[model samples]
Target: MTGVSLGFIPEPLLVALDHILPSRRLPSTVFDSRKFRQIKASIEEIGLIEPLSVTAMDQATGNYVLLDGHVRLLVMQNLGLVDAVCLVATDDESYTYNNRLNRLSTIQEHIMICRAVDRGISPERLAKALAIDITSILKKLSLLKGICTEAAELLGDRQFSSDLSRVLRKMKPTRQVECVELMVAANNVTVAYAEALLVATPVARLVEGKKPARLAGISPEQMARMESEMGNLQAQYRLVEQTYGQDVLNLVLAKGYLAKLLENESVTRHLQQHYPDLLTEFGVVVETVSLDRRHFAETT
Candidate 1:
């Protein structure tokens, strides 16, 4: 059968079962047919009142290929349904269309924004189009090129705080949860402070052998109750970049100094006067000098 072009789908259409999947190029992974069978059973039982999305492809091997509705097409195949009606398109067009600009959740939005930026979408243009903070636009877009989707989701959650972005950026994905735990448990802490250590060290030095101490006054038994909260994301989560977190990296760096300066009484006092409740604001302190006097003199 000869294929033709269909545009701006006012309605969803179907393509033949065989032609729907990527024939010569099956994705390395795909939605399992067993899952589709369940969907098919439900849809078939109810009648496919909602049309499945598809793009008809004309290829040398066969007549058509399905772009987006692999599951429905597979289900239909199992049900011995063929000759499905579909809007036609080429393989390349669907590639962009399937993954193109669209609304997403904060996390999903991050993924999309990242993809757009990677494709050379300007930060200024993206921010203007999205009606969001350019910094935020860049941060969301940074997820694709900077942090793993797993860690990005963690940062995007409002409760998680922008500080985690520093941690996620500086620490290796393998070390992220450990860093997060250290972040929460440390007496003096902030996203920025934790981020500095993450950038500087692989893991914070937690006391070995679990003796004579507790985190945040929580007993060991109580701490164990929320074990999952401190757990790493599922392994399927891909964190590709070394420079994963950058949005609030400045705070992270500033806190590094703050944490250091607080170690001395004189410096802490200076910080308190200049920064105002510096300890609470920074979760640490700052010193007037570049470094500790003893260390500075020794280095010089």
Candidate 2:
């Protein structure tokens, strides 16, 4: 016999909000947040972009248990909405649906806005639908204007601030790509990090020939030194990136082996008596999983 295939039914039905009950209660404080207000406005303007997820409470009764979209349901209830369209799941496993979803990234959001604008949806309507100011919508629309396509694509799925895009636009295409790569590799796409990268940028690689007055803290000589150091650091980082995965794997294996050896009292006692420092270092390495923090062994 083959295993049963189970998933949410593709067909959604309009279920009365009263009949579908929430599985968990939201904190009272959530209702007063700016996020809740935006959600309420978005629901009012767009009439629920994403439908709720629910499962039948009983096989015979039509009443359903709300699986996900708790905030959206609350918004609907606040607006005196009677019913909502919901995807019905065959089984009641709501945890996967709630936790395993990906929210839109900043670049992905920018692309969505651009596509909507191209599709003839005015920025005013978009602002109303998203419950944000028109100025915010315009910023999202202009997100990738001066950014190179390569860098834009690299950060497409990352949740970075829009201000980073502005900083990257000031650099030449090659420099822009390098900066994006560094940001992605480090998993830090903050405005401050982007500004640091821009500061280290050589004047020749800048979009404008002259240096900016905003970077007053760094003199021309200091900027030149930063550029040299950044180049060397990037080279070193690239070399580390090449072996980082395998290095981590090897470290994990070594830590596991050491942990097992230390589990034996005789082995641990022998190491403690003959090589106390070495045993302490091994213990520190076994405690931490990150190779980047291996300095914990040396510091101790």
Candidate 3:
């Protein structure tokens, strides 16, 4: 940071805080009332030790730009204080002030770091100041790198990066977005389950006989577990197949994922590819997208 010696002239008047602060200095869809309430109460009781920073707009406008401490200034203004001390800080200096140390990130925190860079802060500089590994920072940025605006809209604090990464990792951008729509339409977003559905749905449609898989109303975790258990069964069967051949294992351990899969033609190939050794230890999941579509088609 550059050492600065700048003088402050304190002159403040009541102005709409919203007008004074331009667009958000950060990417925030949610303004936490609980945190703000606590902060407001604390400032009202103890008084503001750190002064707010502001800049003059112009000679005629009688407006000032708040560079930092918007929350504290708003609290004071709401309390009917006519004027409070404000320091003059350049917008450049304003970005670096009072940011806390980073711990493991919540989704929002990671988003903000990218937003900061998108606003023209250098990634190297921003990463250093944020005290995060640059590689991880870049990896998270890659999550939305080529995601269509349509698909990216489906992403948010909880699963934005993760979900986008999952789909984009496997398919073309157009297909990635299509997958994202299904994910949101189902009100769910996670990598494995989304991928499973993406692969499962179309195949189920194309298969000639029997109905498609039932994909909806199932959480990613459940699908993952089902796959895991099915994997164990496959391993057992494979051992049996090796010792006694397919005829014996098919007799005892056969009526699980494979039976269910064989019952449907469309997603059978997908199950074979993504989950080899269906009942072995590789795990397999019944293709749900196909099943649900079939159920709907039949009911109709």
Name the best candidate (by TM-score). 2
Candidate order (TM-score): 2, 3, 1
Worst 10 residues of 2 by lDDT: 291-300
Task: State TM-scores per candidate.
Answer: 0.27, 0.84, 0.30
lDDT of 2 by residue, 51-125 (tens): 898886565776788888899899999999999999888876756366545688898798888998998989998
Model 1: clashing residue pairs?
14-85, 20-66, 114-141, 169-245, 192-252
lDDT of 3 at 176: 60
Residue-wise lDDT of candidate 1 within 1-300, one digit each (tens)?
897654445554554565555433434343454455456655554444334444554556665545555555555666777756555543345552345324334555566666767788677766655444578765555543435555444434323433346446545554555454454434333566564443333123222223222234655554554333343322212231233346236545775766766678997688677876646756522342234444546633
Better of 1 and 3 by TM-score: 3
Give the candidate order by descending lDDT.
2, 3, 1
Point out where model 1 deviates above 4 Å.
Answer: 1-34, 49-62, 90-97, 100-300
Q: What is the C-alpha RMSD of each candidate to the true structure, in Å?
A: 21.9, 4.8, 22.6
RMSD (CA, Å), candidate 2 to true, equals 4.8
Number of the predicted model whose lDDT against the real structure is largest: 2
Model 3, position 69, has a per-residue lDDT of 71
